[model samples]
Every structure is written in C-alpha cells, then in structure tokens.
Target: MGPFTFISRNSTRIIAGAALLGLVLPGLADALRPFLGYCVLTMLTVSMLRVDVASFFARVRRPLPAICAGLWLVVVFPLTLLCLAVLLGPPFALPLGLTIIFIFVAPPPIVSAPAFAMLMGLDGALVLAVTLIGTVVMPITAPTIASFFVAETMPISAVDLALRLALMISASFALAFLLRRLLGPGRVAAARPVLDTVSVVVAIIFALGAMDGVGARLLTDPGLTLGITVGSFAFALAQMALTYAVFRPFVGVDAVAMGYAAGNRNAGLVVAALGVTQIDDMVWLIFALSQLPIFFFPMILKPLGRRLVAAHSAVPNARSLP
Candidate 1:
C-alpha cells in the first residue's frame, strides 16, 4: 500500500493532505498561480458535498456547546492572538501576529470539524454542525478581524465579505448537493476513499499555490523564515494547551475537537489574506512556512489522544453515571 493509503485509513489525512500539497505542486508553478482560486473552489466544493447539512445541524440538540464553539472562532481566537502579537512585539512580532490573526479571521479548516471529531473522539456529527456554521460566518468575520492588523490592505469592508461569502457558500452547497445526490446513498460509502484521494490531489495544488505565493521571499530571508517557523510552532503549542485547559472541564472529546481546531489555522486562507499586499506578501512567506507545525503535530498528539480515550473508557461507573 502507498503511504497515502496508510494515512487514508488513519485520522491524520489532514496533515498528509498538507504535506502532499507542499511537495507535489511546485513543478507546476506557472499554471498553479492563476488557478489557485479554482483550486480553492474545488476543496471547498468537496467539503460542502461531504456535508449533510440537515443531518449535521440536527446533531446540535443543545445550544451551549454550539455557542461556545462559535465564540471560539469569532471572539476568543482573535482576541487571544491579538494580545499575543502585541506582547511579542518586531521583525518577528508583527508578521507572526498577522499570521495568527489572518488565520483567525479566515475560514476554519475545510476538514477541521471532521478531523477533530475523529482524532479527538468528539461527536463527528456535532463537530460537522459547528464547522458548517463557522464557514458560513467566516467571510464576514475574516475581513473584519483582518482589518485590525492590516487596515491598509483590507479596503473591502465586512459588507463586501458578506456578499462574497454568500456566493462561495452557495457554490459550496450547490455543488455538494448535486455530487452527493448523484452518488446516491448506498454508493456514498464507497466514495469516501475516492473523495480522500481527490482531496489529496486538490491539497497538493493548493499547497503549490501557497508555495509560489511566497517562493520569492523564502529565497531571500533565511533568518526571518527560521524565526517564523519556530515562533509559529510555539504559538501552535500554546493554542493547543489553552484549548485543552478550556475544554477539558467539559469533556475529553470536546477538548480534542477544540484543541485541534484552535491549533490548526487554515494556512491557505492565511496565505491568501497576506497576499493582499506586497509588503504583507513579503512577510507572509515565513507565515506560510510556519504552517508546517500543523502537519507534524499529529504524530505526537494522535497516540496521546488514543491513550486518553482508553483511560477515559476505563473509568469505573463513569458511563453508568452519565
């Protein structure tokens, strides 16, 4: 079996998807640039098709957890990173802060809810619900938050974001609905493997675009690149720790979901937003490279998550009491 086959069978395909993106697309640099937007459209389309909107939302039988997850994306994430960026302050500080805020404002990872549900052992259905809701909300939230650090570049207001979001969200929902309907219910089970394969292809193309977006800058400043990578990894670890502290009191699975979501910012969106300006683009190379941390975090965390699951399962009378 291919290494991808191994990853496909596991819950860490999100990382694998990113790695494939980084490695596979640079050769197609010329073609990849103009079409990065289409590459994004494909990923989003696949994500939408995979979602069962009615079924996903139905799982949110309660209001509080859903609300908390929303708050994480909209408020807590941005505010926390803004504080961190201010505290860090410089060559490393402003750019790193922009990376954090760019992603904070960007849409949640395309696969985050599902990946979090699987890896952290949360309710996949509920996670899916939250992800869908967050996505619809992102276009508005993203530009607004992006404006704080990047005022000059972000001339488009939240109203524009709302309009753009409506278009993209509608496109996602439409394509997904058609694809799923054509696949049919029984055949849908067989499609996961196929969809996973396609996701890898699209991911590589997306990564290539990301690489090209910053390739020139990366070639110029090795020190800045190194600093951003190290700093980003540190930030990721901090976010994960914060997530665990916040959500552990609620449930282990919930903690896992929040931890991954909080830690793994969508690098594609981060890169795109930073590309809004020439100066921002120059600094964004480091931020783009910084995303390597997410693609690696799973190796250590996955095994630990499994152990936590086993330990939780072993708790005497816990299940019965609940």
Candidate 2:
C-alpha cells in the first residue's frame, strides 16, 4: 500500500504518536500556534470533503435525534458542569470553571468524530449529522451560553467570538464544497484513505498547537499540571459514561456515537477563538490535558463499540425496543 493508505490505516497510532510529539516538543507547538486558525480550517475542510451532502441533509430532515444530541451537548451538559462548579465553588476557581465550561460548550470535534465512529463500527452517518448540526449552531449557541457563564471576564467578546466561529465554519464548508465540485463524489469516495491521512496530519498540527506551553507549565508547577491532567481524563470519561447511559435507553447502539461526541469536545476551537496568549496558564493547562482522551479514547472504545453493536443486533427489533 501507498504511504497515504498506510497512514490512513494506522490513524489511531498516528494520532497517539503525534500527541506524544506534542508533549515532548513544546517548541514545535509554540511555533505552530500562530497558524492555528488556518490549521483548524484545513482540518474542518478536509473532514467535510468526504461527506455526502445529500445524505447529510436527509439525516437533518429527520431532526429529532440530532436536535436531542445538540441540546444535550451545547446546553444541558454545560449547564450541568456550571452547576457543579457553583456547588464546588472554593475548589473550582472562576477562571478554571469558565474554562471547563468553555470546553464542554464547544461543538464536537468535527474532523475526527465521524472517522472515529466508523473505525468503531458505529453509526458514522449519525455522528456526522449530530456533529454538523452542533458545529453549525455553535457560533450562536456557544456565544449565548458563554455570555451567561463567562460574561465580561471573557478574553474575547461574545459577539466577536461568534463572528469568528461563523466565519471559520462557513469558510470550511465553502472550501469543502468547492473541492467536492472539482473532484466529484466518485473521486472523493475513492480517496477516503487519502482524506483520512490528510485529516490525521491536520490533527497532528492541531495537537502541537494545543500543547503549546503545556510542557513549561508541567515543569513550573508539576503538582497543578498533574492534577489537571488527571482531572481532565476523569471528566472526559464521566461525560462519556453519563451520555451513553442517558441515550442508550432511547437510541441503542447509537448511544455510543452520542457518547463519543459528548466526551470528545473541540476544545481547539475555543483555544483558537480565545488565542493562546489571551488564556491564563491554568486554563491552558486544562485544555491541553483534555486533548488526551480525544486522541486516545478510540483505542479503548473500538472493542466496546463492536460489543455494543453485536449486542444490539442480537435483540429483536432493537430500534423499536429502544
């Protein structure tokens, strides 16, 4: 097989290796930080290039599940985190709480989510539908929710952040459409492995950018850095478990897809919007550590997904039963 094919086939390892590189080479992350917006746009565009617009729209037309996923992701989940922050007022600093809220409120990781779902033998179409809606609505809902939680203290104004998000998302969609028009669906389909390779490479750039300053923070405050890293992993796993349980009763095997979306947020989007310089060190540390689960969870989740799919299939009229 060609290099692209090999890279695509080993995407999980590629992601893990890229993440390891980011942790070890903090300077590379700092170097790439300036171009994070372009990197994000490229990742989003490549992800969208392989989508079937017609099927995506058709799924949108059946909007119940998508809306449920959106509301849960953008609203309920953030609010739950906000409430927890409020209840644990002393332990959770205002800035750290807001940072946590920002991470949860952000849209699903559009670039790798569908690919991850497919890798696990789950419903990629369902993931695509939910992620698209969540991403498109992020500029509006994210800003509105963020304004309530963060208000004047936010590094960027709500309106400005929303505008940037809208522009980036729009530009990605437009570029992806242009590519699809030029390449045609047949070519796009045939080039899935290449696109996957491109997506993983873009993810590596993002990982590097996300890890900017993380190593320095680790050296400066080892205890705080370690605490936040562990906390981030716990939070991610808890979010996944809760979301899966809640949706399993209603959606069966698709619950795993929703859970993945809930757990793997696009914290990079928030990081890009706020800019690395604008964020506090603690907040940056948390955000950087949160990326761990997003990159590595696929390894743990793939076998679980297969088991869930098999279990669901064994049931009579599983969809109706749910």
Candidate 3:
C-alpha cells in the first residue's frame, strides 16, 4: 500500500503530525516568526483556487445533511463550546474558548475537505457543497456567532464579514467556472494531483507563517500558552466526536460522506479573522494549535470510516439488484 493509504488507515499520520508540531514548536522562531500572515494568505489562496464551485452547488437536490452539518459548524457547536468554556474551563481560558469558538464560526478550509473526502471514501461533491455553503454563509453566520463571546474585543460585525465573504465566493465561482469551461470535466482528473501537491506546500508555508511571532509569546507566558495548547486540543477532539455522533446512525456510504464533510473544516479562515480583528496574539496561537486536531482527525477516525465503507461495499448489490 502507498504511504497515504497506510497513514490514513492507521494513526501514524496523526502521531507524526503532532510529533512534528511538538518538535518544531520550540524552535519556531527560525521557521514561523517572520512570515506568518503572508504564509497563511498563500495557503488560503491556493485553497480558494482548488474549489469546484459548479460541482459544489450542482448536487443541492440532496442538501439537508450538508446544510445541517454547516449549521452545526457555524452555529450549534460554537455556542455549545463557548458555554462549556464559560461554565467549566478555567477563568483564564476565556481567550482559548473564544479562539475555539472562532474556528467553528469561520469558513471551511479550502484544501483539507477534498483531501479528507478522498481519505475516507466520501463523495467529494458533498464535501465541496458543505465547503461552499459554509464559506458563503460564514460572513453572516460567523459574526453573529462570534458576537456572543467577543463583543468587546471585536464586537462582531456581520455586515463587514459578509462583504468579505461575498468577494471570496464571487471570485471562487468565477474561477471554477472559467476553469471548467476552458478545461472541461476531464481536466479535474489531471489537475487534482498538481493541486494536491500545491495544497500541501502552501499549507506548510501558511502554517509556518502563523507561527511567526508565536515562539516569543510561547516563551513569555508558558502557562497561558499551555492552556491554549490543551484547550485547543480538547476542543478539536470534542468537535470530531460530535461530528461522528451526529452521523453514526447512517453507517456505510452516507456515514463516510457525512463523517468526512462534518469532520473537515476551513479552520484557517478563522485564523485570518483573528488577524483582521486584531484580537490578542494569544487567540491566534490557540487557533493555530487547533489545526492539529484537523490534521489528525482523519488519521484517528479514517480506520473506522473505512471499515464502515468496507462493510457497506460488501453487501453486494444490496442497493442495486436486478
């Protein structure tokens, strides 16, 4: 089997990603200190280019599950996490709580969803739909959700966020259409591999950029830093668990599809928002650390998702008997 197959089927990728983050984290000054936001913008742009807008909205005939997942990410999950942070977490954890909530409120990651769909054997179209929908609705939904926790620092302006989102959607739609019309359906087959490689390189650069000033902050206030690290991880785990729970009843193809769509999100968008709002740098650190959960979830959950897909695939001609 190939490396991705082996890594996806086991927890190796997750462990490796976490280990790399840990090992490099202490020495991030050399890697992430200078180019954080610029790197983030590079990855975000690549992800935007990868979107297949036509395919995303074409399958809207069966959009209930996708819409529900969007609602959860943009609404229910954020509120619940905020409530949990306020009620149960340490008082100082407020910033981390806000950071976690912010991630759920942000638009979907442009690259990860497609990668996730392939890994878990989900319908790429479905994942794309959720990604499109989430990004479209983020401007309106995100500010509304973020308002609850950040009324002071940012005070939540839905109108401003919505305008920004509209520009992204319009640009993405135009690009996807232009490419589709120019290259036709078959082009995606060839384009995907190149895009995948580009996505990874861009993601690494973006991630490094986000870490730019973090080493100093991490060194200055290790306690707060530790809280963010732990809080972000816990929140990521909770979101993943919640996603699985919501889709468990639909085991098989739908289950895998839902799991992939639900689990993967555009967390980097939230990181961008943190920058735009000029919130505390600690908040950005929390969100950056939260990316670990996104990277690792497929590794942690793909085996179960694959097993479900296999079991379903085994029920030969179950849905198509002549």
Candidate 4:
C-alpha cells in the first residue's frame, strides 16, 4: 500500500505507539521543539479541514441540547474544576501545573471525537454537534477561565488572548477554505488519507516533545511526577463517570460518547490558540499525562462499547416481541 493509505489504515495503532514511543525519544522532542507553534497550527488547520460547515449549521437549526452540552463543556466544566481546586486548597492546586484546571479551560475534545464516537457505536452526530459548538465558543471562554486561575503567569491578558484566539481560529478556517479552493473539493476530499497521515505525523512529533523531561523528572522526583500522572488518570476517569451520570437521563445512549469528550480536553488546541510556543516541563508533564486516557481508551473501550451496543440492539427486539 502507499504510505498514506498505510498510515490512514493504521493510524490508531500508530497514534497509540506514538504516545509510548514519546517516553523514550527525548531527542525527537528536542528536534521538534522550535517548530512547536507551527506544528500546533498545522494540526488545528487539519482539524478545520475536516469540519463540514454546512452540515454543522444544519445541525444547529435544532441543537438546543447540544448547545447546552457545549456550554457546559467549555464554560461550566472549567469553572467546576476551578471550584474543586479552591475547595481542595493548595495541595491539589499547584501554581505551575494546574493539570485538572487546564483540562476544561483548554479547547474542546480532540478533533477525532466524531470518529471515536462512531467507533464506539455512540451518537457521532451529537459528538459532532458539541464539538462544533465548543470550537465556536472556545475563544471567548478559554481566556475567561484561564484569567481567573492563571492571570499573573499568563503570557497574554484575557483580552489579548481573546483577540488572538479570534484571529487564529478565523485564519485557520480561512486557510482551510483557501486550500480547498485551490485544490478543488473533490481533490481535497480524495486526499483524506494524505491529510490523516500528516495529522498522525504532527501528533507523533507533538507527543515526543510533550513527553520531554518526563522521564528525568520521574527519576528526580518520583513522588510529584508519579502523583500527577496517577491523579490525571484518576481525575480523567472521574470526569467521564460524572459526565456520563449527569447527562444519562437526558441524552441517553449518547452519554457515553459525550463523557468520552468531556474527560479528554485537547490541550494542544489551547496551546495553539494561546500562542504559547514553549511550555514548562511541569506543564508539559501534565499535557503528556492528560494524553493517557485519550490514547488508551480506544483499546479498552471496545468491549464496553460492544456491550452497550448489544444491549441497545436487544432493546428494540425486546419491545417488538409479544
């Protein structure tokens, strides 16, 4: 098979491997460090390319529930994290590594939520709806949340960030449109594999850099490093559980998929939108650790998803039977 086709076919395996490989390849991290900004932008633009704007607006016509879900994700969820941080006091809220706090304040879920939702037999359309709304709401909400928690340390003020975010997101959409226009829609559509291959490569590069110093930090301060790592996993699962619980009655079967996006925030999107080129290793550690649930879930979720799918499949049959 051609390299692009191969990559597209095996992207999940490659993505999973990339996360593990990052732990061992700090050199790859160094090589990719300078280009981090561009890498972030490239990844964001690629995501924009996949967005079906027409379909999104069509979905928007009667999307009150999805809009609320998106609001909860980008606004309420981050505020919730901040409240928890306050209640828990200083021990849980490290100044440099506000890991859990960052989770919600960051952008929406990774661009693959719709695909992941489909893979698990969940509501891909709901996932897409929330994702689209979250992206639209992010520029305004991101800085609002970040300013409340990290104002002094932030590189830019909330207003500046809001402006930058607006420009960057707008430019990305413009870039995507320009590319499609230049290449033509059919040609662009035909290049899905190629675009996916590029995204995979960008993700691999990002994973490696993000994991830089993580090993040495573990060696130097096993307690802190391991603590954050474990806590990230725990909090991630808890977020998913809580989200699933809260939305179950209302959203039904889609709760699992919504929770899937809820727990895994796309920090990379925040990094890109915030225009932060260099992040501290402590911060990077959080970014790296946040990735575990996202990368590993697909492996473990299949059986659960299968069971859920089976249960729902049997429901209609049961109803139809006398």
Candidate order by TM-score, decreasing, is 2, 4, 1, 3
Model 4, 160-228: lDDT tens per residue? 878877786777778987887888777877888999899889877776666666766777888997888
Task: Give the Å shift of residue 203 in candidate 4.
Answer: 1.2
Point out the higher-scoring one by TM-score: 2 or 4. Answer: 2
Error at 5, model 1, angstroms: 5.9
The worst-scoring run of ten residues by lDDT in candidate 1 lies at: 270-279
- Taking all chains together, the TM-score of candidate 4 against the true structure is 0.88
- What value of lDDT does candidate 2 attain over all alpha carbons? 0.79
**Candidate 4, 122: how far from true, in Å?**
2.4
Q: Write the per-residue lDDT of candidate 2 for residues 65-184, one digit (tens) a residue.
A: 777987888777777777677678855537667656666555564567887988999878878888887888889988887787777567888999899888889998999999899989
Best by lDDT: 2
The local lDDT score (0 to 100) that residue 162 gets in candidate 3 is: 57
**Tens-place lDDT digits, model 1, residues 167-210:** 76678678888878888865665676777667667766555555
Candidate 3's residue-wise lDDT over 1-322, tens digit each?
Answer: 6553444344335444543464356565345434544444554454556656676666576677677766766677667667777777666246655555666545553446665666766567766666667777777777776666655555336556556556655665576567667776677655655655555555555555555445566678888877876776675555556675666554335545655554456666654544534645656566556566566666666687678678877875433101
lDDT of each: 0.60, 0.79, 0.59, 0.72
- Where's the lowest-lDDT run of ten residues in candidate 2? 313-322
Steric clash count of candidate 4: 0
TM-score of each: 0.78, 0.93, 0.73, 0.88
